[model samples]
Target: MAPRPNVVLVVMDTARACETVHERYDYLSELNRLAQTGTEYTKAVASAPWTLPSHASLFTGTYPSKHGAHAGHKHLDEGIPTLAKAFQDGGYETVAVSNNTWISEEFGFARGFDTLYKTWQYVQADIDLGKIARTKQGTEMIHALATRLAEGNPVINAANAIYGQFFRKRTDDGANRTNKWIREWLANRNDDEPFFCFVNYLEPHLEYRPPKSIAERFLPNDVTYGEAMSVPQDAWGYIAGTVDLTDRQLGILRALYRAELAYLDRCLGELRRHLEAAGEFDDTVFVVTGDHGENIGDHGLMDHQYSLHETLLHVPLVVHGPRFETGQVDDLVQLTDLAPTLLDAADIDAPELRDASQGRSFHPEAEIPPREHAIAEYMAPQPSMDALRERVGTSTDNIERFDRSLRAIRTDDEKLIRGSDGTQEFYELRNDPEEATNLATERSERVDTLETMLDEWLDTFERADTSGEVSMTDATEARLEDLGYLQ
Candidate 1:
């Protein structure tokens, strides 16, 4: 019998569909080329708007409520089954390389893989320094001597700290390191087991500083690199109405984000070439998708929080392999369904995954029922209001406005967003693609129907038993802060 095909899941963190799709950017030639040989889902929606919960839904074939990872809770319930665990149990070698701190082993995202590399650790100079400054007396003596050299001068000490934190870290978001490690691992593995590799590229997430060589090609004529670098990375301040960005700042941010997307496309092309060179291209199932999208001045928001509009929900999903047919699928699909589809491809049967998941298979050969509507949930504010207040150094009137939770359901034509604070928003997606108009008050009957459908879906939610605390290192906290997650 032929060996089972390998599976590779690549997540483009915070990539929005409006910009990354083939129709939008000419710089995404690699991604567009890959789509020609695979199926691209143009209407794929995320289960949540942010990272942790959206990823939890991606790992498990369940929604955020079922997985119990959101703003209210940071830990994914340990009892839930993960896709990596299922593949490992099915005899495939599982490995993961992630640049995001939230997807690290500390958060239970590494439970299923044989080896999960936190690429951020490799980029930090202090982690490398720790190797030479071990606990032994010889190492301690060297560390003490180095510390004493810059001990007295406050300016020197500040400069050293800045260098250790920012100047020494990789600005590419570890994509280069991730590819190098994957190629090395593929070359060294002697076993013939089909491998499951999960990779995440975070270059487009925030602080969108693409490499200068690539950024120059995508920047607008009026935007300068200095202007892009000067744009505030503080989404919280902007959302709270405490800080207002000038039009010039917004333009700089948009240009830099597009540059990052172009860079990501180049990385994807490099990865595919590596797989082909390793003699595993044709036998590998490649799944390229985004966890959720960012809000770049959409709905007056700078980050992906406090809203469930199309800008945050709509994402790009492309599947390529021996099992998937090559074409475009406009069907409404959820990211949660990917787990079942992959498991079906590998012929692995895990009752836990099936029983726990709310998703259906989209495999061409599978006889699954059609989806009527797509659902997305957003729990109360992430980087909580208190955290926002601390970051901006004062309270604003808009703080209370975003404290409520949100749930949205969308059909092919219309969408309804309901908030826990009794607010409702309705949009006709075909006519108002930008979601600029609200018909909640104008069309009462249609709003009621969508609300009822949303209610029925909410009733099926069985909240997972997620009761635990997260313990993170100081470096991890600092990295998260740099990403604008923490204050």
Candidate 2:
């Protein structure tokens, strides 16, 4: 038998499928090229709309309910087997280069990694700068310092003001830094052994600040980061109709997001180049995908947490390797499937859990039945809701309205989103791709059928016991706050 191929999983944090690979934006040129040479599951859905749970599902090959690393329980249950663990058990060198703090050693995300290079450790200064910039007082203090530094030269002062007000100094180039670490590791690793590498890039997440060159390519003449930051940080305020933005401003936000994607595309290209130069490109299996999608302005929400809309659940999945065929699959797939698919590619047996893996391999040669529908869930604790409302000064009722636990089921042509508060929405995806029209009231039969399917799917997984609370450090909380996840 041929030697097992190396596996590289790149999880692009908060990248929407529509923006990255879809025709609308086409911002990820490098990824698009890789798709041409591999299989692209165009309709991949994430198990959850947020980071921790979705990543847990991706690693565990099960729903968020099974692994139970969500808002209520912030750590993955150690009993459940992870993809990295499977590879490690199979004798592969497991390495992780993660930018998201939720995927750190403290969260059980380092279970099977031989070497884990967390971006935060290398970029603490950048994280500190981001935390400082998120507050009004901190922004004012930075502005004062910039003003003082630019007193000698008028041109230098103007540049400093723009830097202080609009440009965030990114001391860490997220994926670029991770790629450098990966390349350095590859140089030191033994070529005889196969490796499983997982990388999480945070370029497309909140407080979007792309390079100026990239930002100018997509944005209009007047759109500025200073202006975009002026909007309320609390997405609930906008969802509750307390904060309003003009269409042009929303357009600017979208442009900023696309620019960030563009910047990430370049970084991915750099990583690919490094792999090719190392002569390991052909022998490696590469899976590039997003943990979850981001909501730029969809459904009156700013980031991803409050809704299971297509903008948040639908992510881009591209699998390239010697074992995979090169074609596009329109079949609906979930992020949970990635774990099994990757394991299948590596020829490793998936570990058994309370529930059998809900994920099926998407490899073209696999004889799996077409997935009928995909489900996504969201659950936020009452304390988190209260804290967010206190920070944003929004009413508890209003915040809770959107923050309630909910489940959504989406088929190829239709989608149904139901909240714990008895609010439900259904859309015929073919005609209402944007999901603007809610058909739950009009189409009773369709709602009943889909709801039954959702309920049956829910029955397959046992709910995890989250009685043991997981606490994060103060620094971790501050980082999440800067990313707008805590606030």
Candidate 3:
């Protein structure tokens, strides 16, 4: 019998399908090359608008409402089984390396992993500190020390003061560190057991600070790197209508966003080379996807929240393995489907997993099942109204508009977004890909049908039991604030 293939799930945080797959950059040749060797779902949609809920859906094979991990509830309920848990139960060595603070152990993301590494805890360029935190236990010990310092441990004040300088200067957001750890793990991991590794690259997320050489290609000839960095990376300001970005500023933001993705593409190529050198590239299953996308001035928004438009919902999904078919698939697949599909690849019979999941596996050998629509949800306002007001130091009438929850349902050609306030926006996606026009009143019958479908689909699952509150360390909270996810 053939050995069970090892699996690696790579989540490119805040990467969109439009910028990466639909209208790919020349520098994204690595991603494009990977897509050619495997099945690339062009119409893949995320389960939520942002990191927490979308990742929850990916892990549990359920929607935000079912998983109970959304803006309203920041923790993944302990009742729901995760993809890593399933793989671990089936005797696979499970590992996770996350750059985003949202995917940390504090949020219940470390449930099934034998090893979990927080990339930020390790010093980026400092050789001595890197050696100290190179191993898993060393990494955790270093993180615990930092957390103690963050919580006002006076005994290590001098050491904390020194380490804080290196911590704040970490600019790459763990792309290099993630790859380095994976390379080391591949070299040392047990060859007898099949492994399941989940890795997240956060370079494409906010505070777009790509390397100068790569940023030069995306920026205008006249715009200097210093000028590009001068633009405010504040999403709340744009949403609240407090800061109006000039056309030039918007262009610079967009350019920087693309440059970040380009730099990540280079890192991804480096990872592939590492895997090849390890001699496990052909036998390993590779799943590359994005949690969600950034707005970067699209629809007058600077961030991913406050909307479920295609820009934030549609993301790239690619699966490559010897058992999978090659070429592009235009099917409307969701990130939720990935869990079941991967479990199937490992030949694990998980009826409980299948029963809990609302998604169907799009395995290559199986015929493409007809999918009526793709659904997305924003269960609650991220950062909250009060938090936004406090963060921005004032409020706007426009801010009240995004205070409500949003649920969206989309077919092949059209989409209907229903807000908690009973307001709805309808768009003809075929002609108006940007979603510039709201045709809810003009197309009443179509909107009604879509709304009905969304309601019926939502009625299928009840909220998961989320009884506990999620608490994070001061250092973790600081990281979230720096990433623009918190005030």
| lDDT, candidate 2, 73-158, per-residue tens | 88987888888888998889999998887888777788988878766543222122323333436668567445444445544444
* Residue-level lDDT for 51 in candidate 3: 97
Which of 1 and 3 is ahead in lDDT?
Answer: 3
Candidate 2: where are CA atoms >4 Å away? 23-26, 123-173, 222-237, 240-242, 351-356, 381-383
The numbered model that scores best in lDDT is 3
Candidate order by lDDT, decreasing, is 3, 1, 2
How do all the candidates rank in terms of TM-score, highest first? 3, 1, 2
lDDT per residue for candidate 3 within 99-150, as digits (tens), equals 8878977888998899888776533221123222222255685674555444
In terms of lDDT, which candidate is stronger, 2 or 3? 3
In candidate 3, stretches whose alpha carbon ends up further than 4 angstroms from where it belongs are 22-24, 123-171, 465-469
Per-candidate total of colliding backbone pairs: 0, 0, 0
RMSD of each: 5.2, 6.7, 5.1
What lDDT score is found at residue 261 in candidate 1? Answer: 91
| lDDT, residue 422, candidate 3 | 92
TM-score: model 2 vs. ground truth: 0.88
